[model samples]
Target chain A: MVEIRMRVNGVSESLDVPPWVSLLDVLREHLGLTGTKRGCDQGACGACTVLVDGERINACLALAVQYTGRDITTIEGVAGGGDPHPLQTAFIRDDGFQCGYCTSGQICSAIGMLAEHGAGSASAVTEHVAATGIALSGAEIRERMSGNLCRCGAYNGIVRAIQDVAESPR
Target chain B: MRPFAYVSAPDVATAVRAIGTEPGAKFIGGGTNLVDLMREGVERPGTVIDITALPLTGVEELPGGGVRIGALVRNAHLAAHRLIRNRYPLLSQAILTGASAQLRNMATAGGNLLQRTRCPYFYDGAAACNKREPGSGCDAMDGFNRNHGVLGVSDSCIATHPSDMCVALAALDAIVEVESVRGVRRVPMAEFHRLPGDTPHLETTLAADELVTAVELPALPVAATSRYRKVRDRASYAFALVSVAAALEVDDGTVTAVRLALGGVAAKPWRAYEAERILLGAPATEESFRRAAAAELAPATGRPQNAFKIELARRTLVETLRQLLTEGSAA
Candidate 1:
């Protein structure tokens, strides 16, 4: 077993796990941080998405041992004591989720996506590859969020929520 | 996943030695593909050698005019590299069209080139897939062949290599540098991936003990007018229905040179040499583009559902060539 110590949701935690133990399993089983839902054990569904060093990644695809010293932020760690982030607030205001199982992933992915675009990362739908921070079109948003599936198909509201937060002031 | 010993190799030499000396050991990079495979019980490696921390992540200008891309360079870095964007436009476009943003950020050049097929039959263990289990009698040949290969496919297997970077690299004539316990060797991009002839299991020429060190791309001056066009079912993360990576040089209304490669149609990155031969020195017209595409697609033998891929591949090529010509003329 490999021993890993990392910060999760601003809290430092350490644990010993086998090589096969996934970050999703470690979060749900070992640490009892069950807010991060697991939709698919494979990497297809983004229910287990979490922020690893400020970037979102599918927790199911990342091994627990691989994130020894990195910083992890789960759905539970997004806001302290009920004050939600702007994206989370926009989701609540826009009724972005019906079941709420995929909300955590959606919020985390949006936060990362905003940061990616803010840093001038281009998406597939970006017409000018060299352009910095191309306007986030609806098509771009859907394409970027394809990894995260919503069973309820609440996509229109989710896109609006993300767009609202992205367009809002800092 | 089965129990395995975990060892983090400090460098490429250590990684190669670890794989060479240890039996039933496998190297792990970003673990985007290998970890998922392990979880699904597809690969059962006794030892997991971590090579993510090796000093192999850089995109530097070669001694000559070309670019030397490290094997550990992530797809995100490649897409953002200024030199690659300016010189190898097709490579950047190809990398952007593949997978998702998150996956691309984690996937490396070596892993992208080495990713296995996403064939449904192979993923489903109950189904007979020769690529996954040799002599299993490929169930995909008759059942659900929508995503299977149509060009350069054999009776043994019909799966296509699932990589966008490889399609562009094949067109650019890139070279893969590998380091093994014996020594270092280079494999041309054209010969790197093997067709699933009788041995559908053996995907690439890479030996188990070899670690991919770097990938060198020969500089192409005409690459300034290159493009990568992929036609997929959706606008997002779906795999390509038909993809084209094209670099063309037009001078005085005539095609000076052409490098055309295709994906989602063959077991390997189907380099369209016939198309390139027909296109070189030909007039920059849609008729010539169509003719070249036809010459390339003549050898394509499709199954029941994938017959559309032949026409799709042809039209994709024509559309890409037309766009390039139009872009050149405007410039």
Candidate 2:
């Protein structure tokens, strides 16, 4: 057994999980953080998306022991005081979730996407990297968030929700 | 997932020693591919050496005008590096067209090259995969080969290397620096990944104890005009049907220098040496391009659903070459 201490959802949590247990499994089964859904146990689906050290990654593809000493931010931690984050509110306003199964992952992924954009990270669609802050285009947003899939076919609204947040005042 | 021992190596020396101490030990870099395989029972390692914390992340300029990328450098950082974007444009484009944004952030350079194929039969424990089980028959050959290999594929295995960065590195003449309990050695990109012949289980030339430390790219002049193109089922987040990474330099309507490599069509990164030989010093024309592409793909023996890859690869190479030539002429 490996004891790992990580800051999950703004709280310090410690658990002695088997070395092979994935972070997604620990979050859902052991700690009861089921908001991070698991669509496919493999890395194909983004339902297990979470932020480790302020970067989005598929928790299902990560071992919990490998994430020690990292600041973890899951979907449940995005909202404090039972209130929604601005991105979460925007996603709801835009009706981004049709079946609502991939919402948490989608929201967590979009927040990380915005952070990447803010830091001037370029996507496949972005032609210029040295150029200053990129203008968020629909194609850019779609390409950047392509890892997160919503089986409900709600990509259009999700794109719009992310675009709305990207355009909002910082 | 099965039970395993986990240890975090504080530095390179400890990491090297840990691998030698543990049996069936696998180094964990990004955990993007290894962890998924572990969950599916594909990899049953008795020990997992977490190598991510070691101070092995950087993209530094080599003394000889080239670049040395650390093994732990994230895919996103490697793709977005200033020199890589400006000089090695194909490398940047290749990494960007790979997995999604989140996966790129987590995927490391060494892990990306070492990732196993996404063959369904290999992942599904019920099916017979020569790669997963040595002596077992290959189900992909007789079954769904829509994503199987077309070049350098032996009867024993037909899985393709599922990496975009490696394809670009192959074209750029990159070399991988690896360390093991014994010592350190440098492996050229062309010889790093092995073609699955009778021993389908053996993927790379690196020994089990060897750990990839860095990838060194040789300096080149054609890198200024490099490009990477991929044709996939979807516009994004999908593996390539056929991808091309090319760096060309044409002078006075004649091919002065050309470096081309292919992905999603071979057992390894298909470096188009034959095609380069045909195009170098030849005039830039549509007919020459066709002949060159045909020469490069002559060894392509595709399965039923994947025969279209032959034509797609041909067109992709022709298109990329034409674009490069046109951009050169305009400049």
Candidate 3:
């Protein structure tokens, strides 16, 4: 077992884990932060999405030992001080999900997607690769959020929830 | 996943030595592909050397107008790099088209090039795959082959290389830089990946002990105007059924310079050398484009489920060139 230290949801935690244990298992089993669901266990499904240093990645693909000393954010960390994140509220208002199995991942992925877009990152559907300050069009949101899958067929609502958060003024 | 000893390398030399000295040891970068294969029991490394801590994680400009990308540079960062977006937009476009936003965030440049084929047979332990196990008969040959290769295939195996970025790199005339205890060597992009002849197990020119340090993209002005077109089952988050990476230069309605490479059709990124030769000094027209595509694909062979790839490749190549031609004229 290797001793690993990391900051998850603003708490510094240390644990001894085997080399092969995935971050998903460590978060779910070791720390009991089960909000990060494991739908596919592979990278195909976005149900295990989490933020490492503010960038979204699949937790199932990351080895727990590899993420030493990194700041990781999960669904539990999204809302601060007993208030729901605006995106979370929007998800509920727009009915972004039916079963809610993919809700945590979708919310985390959207936060990262918005951060990437704010940094002027281009998506596959972007007309001009060099253009900066890309407008958050519905097509752009759909393309950027394609990584997260909502199997309950709530794509229309999910897109609408994200759009509401993106269009709302800070 | 099997239990493996893990060590974090401090630098390049340490990483190389760890892999060289330990038997059945593998280097882990972004862990996107390697970890998945490990979970599926496809890869069984006894020692996993974590090299993410090595100081090789940025894109730098070479002395000559080229760009040298570090091995650990993540795909998402590489695509958004200012130099890549402005100079090699097609490369940026290609990287964006592959996988998804989350996977790109976790995948590295070196890991992307070294990723194995997504062949179902190779992943299925019950199925026979020469790549997964030597002397094992290939089930993809007679099995569901709609996603298999049509070019550079052998009877022993028929798997396609599954990287959109490599196709663009091939067209841009990139170079792969690798290092080991034996010292460093530079391999041209064309020679980096190997054809699946009798030894389908040997995928790349990289030896087991060697570590990919970086990939260099040589200065090519044509790459600025290049474009990558991937035709897949869906518009987003799907591997290519047929893809084309093309850059064209026309002088007074005559083709002066051209770079063409294909993906989802061969064991390696199929650089269209025959088509490039045919297009040089020829009239920049759809007729010439179609003829060149046909000449390059004449030697291609396909199985029943994948026979459509030949025609799909042909049409994709022609259409891509035509688009480049139109863009050139408009400019």
DockQ of each two-chain model: 0.48, 0.57, 0.65
What is model 1's DockQ versus the real complex? 0.48
Give the candidate order by descending DockQ: 3, 2, 1
Model 3 segments more than 4 A misplaced: B328-331
Model 2, A7-47: lDDT tens digits are 99888999898887888988999899999999887777799
Candidate that scores best on TM-score: 3
Which sections of candidate 1 miss by over 4 Å?
A: A80-82, B328-331
| Every model: iRMSD | 3.0, 3.2, 2.7
Which residue pairs collide, candidate 3?
A: none
Compute the TM-score of each model's chain A versus the native chain A and list the values: 0.96, 0.96, 0.99
Question: Candidate 2 — number of clashing residue pairs?
Answer: 0
Candidate lDDT scores, in order, read: 0.87, 0.88, 0.93
Write model 3 residue lDDT over B184-290, tens digit each, in one string: 99999999999989999999999999999999999887777778889998889988888998888889999999999999998889999999999999999999999
Interface RMSD of 2: 3.2
> By lDDT, who's the top model here?
3
Decide which is better by lDDT, 1 or 3. Answer: 3
Instruction: Give lDDT tens digits, candidate 3, residues A25-127.
Output: 9999999999999999989879999999999999999999999999999999999899999999999999999999999999999999999999999998887
Query: Tens-digit lDDT track for model 1 on B1-331?
Result: 8788999888888899889888989988888989888877888898999998899999999877899999889897788787887788888888989987777777899888899998888888889989888998898888898887888899999998888889999999999999998999999999999999889899999998989989999978877778888898877788888899998898999999899999998889999999999989999899999999999999889899888999999999999999988764111
Evaluate residue A166 in candidate 1 and report its C-alpha lDDT on the 0 to 100 scale.
Answer: 77
Candidates 2 and 3 compared: the better one by lDDT is: 3
For every model shown, the clashing-pair count is: 0, 0, 0
